[model samples]
Target: MNDEEQYSVWPHGTPVPAGWRSTGFSGDETTCLAHIDEVWTDLRPRGLREWLATRS
Candidate 1:
């Protein structure tokens, strides 16, 4: 995850990108993707969510 709350799968041994951190969940691609699907119920980015919140 990153400041935007987006999720993705990275290779186990590779360094995570500068802005992103691990969710501490590691597994095969299918499992990782399932985890993302389960947790990431809202697809909007952080900025969009915050902006929408202000509107509401």
Candidate 2:
């Protein structure tokens, strides 16, 4: 997730698509979800950042 909080997921062994990079983690469904659960604690979108910045 960039400064934007947008993210993408591809199946195991799939090539990384253009404009995307690996987060250096991989696993099966349960493992992947566990990783996401641990890492993606913030669900807010990039728009929220922009909005908050304007408010400041």
Candidate 3:
């Protein structure tokens, strides 16, 4: 994930993008996606979530 808290699947053994880091979970595409679905319940980005928190 990046500063935005978004999740994506990167090919194993490939270098991750500059702003993104591994969640330390590596697996096949389906498994990765399922893991993301389970953990990333909040779809909002970090900035948006912080802003909403301030409003609340």
lDDT of every model, 2 decimals: 0.95, 0.75, 0.95
Each prediction's RMSD to truth: 0.6, 2.4, 0.6
Residues 1-56, candidate 2: write the lDDT tens digits.
44466566679788877657788777787887788788887678778968988998
Query: How do the predictions measure up, each by TM-score?
Result: 0.95, 0.64, 0.95
| Better candidate number, 2 or 3, judged by TM-score | 3
Report residue 29 deviation for candidate 3 (angstroms): 0.4
Residue-by-residue lDDT tens digits, candidate 3, 26-56: 9999999999999999999999999999998
Model 1, poorest ten-residue lDDT window?
A: 2-11
Residue-level error in angstroms, candidate 3, position 32? 0.3
Q: For candidate 1, lDDT tens digit of each residue in 1-56? A: 99999998999999999999999999999999999999999989999999999998
Which ranges of candidate 1 are over 4 A from the true structure?
none
* Residue 49 accuracy (lDDT) in model 1: 99
Residue 55, candidate 2: alpha-carbon lDDT: 100
Backbone clash pairs for candidate 1 read: none
